[model samples]
Target: MVDSPDAFGRLWADDYPGDFLRDLAELGDRMSGRPGERRAAELVADAFRDAGAREVAVEPFEMNAWKRGSTEFGVTNPVERSFEALALPYSPSGDVHGDIVDVGHGTPEEIEAADVAGNVVVASTETPPGMDRLYHRMEKFGHAVAAGASAFVFANHKQGQLPPTGALRFDREAAVPAVGVSAETGTWLREYADRDGEVSLSVSADTVPGEGHNATGVFGPETDEEVVVLAHHDGHDIAEAALDNGCGVATVVAIARILGDIDLDTRVRVVTVGGEEVGLLGASALADTIESERMRSVVNVDGAGRYRTLRAFTHGTPAFEGVLDSVSDAASREVSVDDALHPFSDHWPFLKREVPAVQLHSVTPERGRGWGHTHADTWDKTDARNVREHGMLAALLVRELTRKSVPRPDADALAADLESRGLRPGMEAAEIWPAHWE
Candidate 1:
């Protein structure tokens, strides 16, 4: 059994995680390929150095970067009213006028049933009830593209005036222009659509070649096998990104401090990646440098520090679940484990390469991104207690993983699991399905 340390007492004394989160927020718009993102990488590298990590480095990679610009969405026929909208990343500059089609929840079934061809399709950010998993925004966008929709509108389901923003595709221009609207505006749009109203959408944006950075360092004993602990430092430019990922990188930093004092059998590599908001660019870049056999396991702290209780996606790896169970039992802190395959997040790039990986998220009552991609994702929405608690659990999990000899997942079996979960269809639609799986 792994012994649990007084993580709360140690963290509470200094509140390093809280301070790190605040520092990241102050960087201002750590968007991928931006100056803020570069500064954030430097800050994380400095934190890693201070945490006693060795060979700390900031790696750079080229990426297809996108910039937000003026977006206009309004009812044109039978009414004249404009709604506040934000152009999703990778949305090309265009002007489209078509009849609005509401595809509730934006499920495959809904898009297939609706006559969305040559029309603007609006889908809610929330998934349909009773669905096994939440449909991602990219999946909805892909479905609309496949159906030949002239444009796509993502409507936030939460009852706030905040419009959500996310990438339309990974590292490429979307087939159609896309934008997000507030829940209130969504209601108005739905009502107007019932009246067979036509709407107009104009988006102005730029897609250019840009660079992404990954701040990386190593701790523990030098070994051929390493356990990766990673979180994305890049966030949407819309908010302070406190909840979406600022908490994640901070938790990673806090865990690094704990790992520095522990004697481990394997090396622990801590990485704070950029371009996760646009795509998993930084993660993919880092993954390419490391061979799958050398990676013992990956513990990604993406949405981990958002709540008190932690939720771990083990990616159908039995060894990962076992480790989490042991950590929970030893630490006496419940970590809700789901042995499911989650294809999003920084872990995906590694998991797709047949590396055993676990993504540490949180247990939240809300279904969709509660305040994740909106302007409301600020530092005020997070609690330092959650960061400290989650960091402790993550550190414990990492420690256990380093000592264990977990087998790598079979590539065929992993692909089959994704297919069984009905994720392949969406992945294929999103153009993220690995060619090897075919």
Candidate 2:
């Protein structure tokens, strides 16, 4: 708790933020498609209207909903053993009560060796090697799924409590419904198979193209202007996105409340993209069409509730460095300026289109860490005050950028910076020079 001049909370408390916290707490409840989120979005729209914005609408997008499918697993042998497990978030359904075949780790080699056709494949957890192996393993898994394995069940790893879980990312032509299971369950299944010779179970689920949406609404009017602020609204569909992004939307809405009441020289756009959990689809869509010419910069807020280590970075040009500093100058003392990878959020698409953007974030390790696409990220982990601070920082930053014109770097300098950052051409860093790096 450093007594710094740039504490964002003081600003968050400004403008008499009455009932804003209550509104944020309610946001969690309203977002569940359950009364929580449904109502939360409504409240946001209402607030937008009250803010005197010209327009406010909830534009819906399509996304598939993964529901529970028929699930049954047990060991059929001298000793009857029933193992516990559940289908992955987007797993396929297989009611095959056939014998369970040990496919080793469900690896391609293991699958090829075993006769798993029409049979359930009890797979062991196979992490190729290093932390970087996840990518190759995932890609490999996609190929394995496409190879026509009847069903995929990930055996528990030596470590990791819950079934080693993951979602499949196949090319446009390939799709596989895979689920992970607990390591204990895997061991039991294996032991049962060794003792019983054959173990049969039922694993069926409602698997198909899911349909949901990336709901979005823009604030402020047209002036060939853009100050895109982002927060992902979608979660695993189990918990309220309170801190995961419920707070993010709340922060964005808070900014709307602050900046909306006053007239600004530049437009302040707020987008709570969907399918962020699944992928950066919503953000990508915006990035695809955003008039880079109009886009000044993007400010993304994620995991705002706990700046236990709030950090910011600039992956953009020199002007963006100024943008980052401008934002940081008003951020909390708890916030640090650290180097990070890509925004990896809805901002990627904008970057692809050459829009200046960066994701404001904080990272926390958990008992079962890396809950990004897991069921572990719940509402209980959210902190309201932290979320408020996140919103406050964004509002102040946007206000600064909208009016203050920073020094734009020349093309060569911008190019050199992008190159040093290992940027690829046509991606976001390709073209720069004499440009605002917009």
Candidate 3:
């Protein structure tokens, strides 16, 4: 059993996580490559210094950044009408007109059978029920590009007139224009498509060379081996980004504060990264420079504080499950464990190098991001109680990882596992498949 630190008790008595989250929300639109993102890096750096961290630095890296402009979507035929929409990141500026084609879930098979050539394709944000894995928005957009669609429309499956926004591709402009619409607008478009309606789409955006930053600081003992605790500080421009990642970085800060007062045997590195909304650019940049062999493990706090119960994706690491169990038993709280390999988050860069990693998210019945990318993702939607409770549990988990001897997965076996789970096809379609895999 892990011993609870006095600092952990102090966390329960204070709302540090929630306060940090609110502070981040006040920065306004911490989008990748934007001024807000730079301010966020500075804020995290200051917070790290205040938490008694050493060697606090804000590292900058070059990247291809996207800026949103104006977007318009309208049905030009069969009862002309206009709708509200937001341009997805990396969508090229274009004006196109074509027949509307609704590819239900935008799965590869659905796109193949729908014959979306020369038409504007509409795909849902939710995947089909009972699918083995979650189909990402980039995967659907990639399939549409391959099928020669003139434009792409991402329709949120959830109701409430909320339009979801995410990137069409990573680090570069997409082949075609893309935009997101509310469920109400999607339903109208689908019904209009049934009557052979046509639509016009115009998306204006800019893609240029830009820079992003990573705020990193180290604590614990003077050991060569270290455990990395990280969360992205970036979010989409459409919302306050409170739920998607404001809570994430806030949890990291709280953990750092608690760790500062605790005795430890291993070094702990805390990082809050930018450019996660466009891609894992900040994480990738840091991973390229770090010594992967000296790393013990990675604890990524991405979506942990969104709900009461926590979920840990172990990336097929059995040792991580044992650590989570220890935290659960010691804290007397529930932490659901899934030993699947998820290749989409900030942990992927380290996991690709054979490092054992776990991503801490919240347990939700909803399939896709419920209000994460929508305008509804505000600070008021979250609870301080959840942040305090989950922050304590994650802090314990990080401490346990530092003491445990976790073995990294073999590179060949890890690659084979990803292939066996039907992830390679989607990775390739999204142009994110590593060149070495080929």
Model 1 spans > 4 angstroms off: 1-8
For candidate 1, write residues 170-277 as lDDT tens digits.
999988999999999999888888889899999999999999999999988888999999999999898999988998898898888777776677889999999998
Clashes of each: 0, 28, 0
For candidate 3, the 10 contiguous residues with the lowest summed lDDT are: 1-10
Cα RMSD of all models vs. native, in order, equals 1.7, 7.7, 1.6
CA lDDT of each prediction against the hidden true structure: 0.89, 0.54, 0.89
Q: Give model 2's TM-score versus the native structure.
A: 0.67
Using TM-score as the measure, name the better of candidate 2 and candidate 3.
3
Model 2: lowest-lDDT 10 consecutive positions = 425-434
lDDT, residue 60, model 1: 96
For 70-160, candidate 3 gives per-residue lDDT tens digits of 9888999987889999999999999999999999999889999986999999999987887767789998998889889999999999999
TM-scores of the candidates in the order shown: 0.97, 0.67, 0.97
Give a tens-digit lDDT track for model 2, residues 131-234. Answer: 22122224334435545655666665644455544434310111334556677788776765565445555656543454333444555556687687777665
Candidates 1 and 2 compared by lDDT, better number: 1
Choose 1 or 2, whichever is better by TM-score.
1
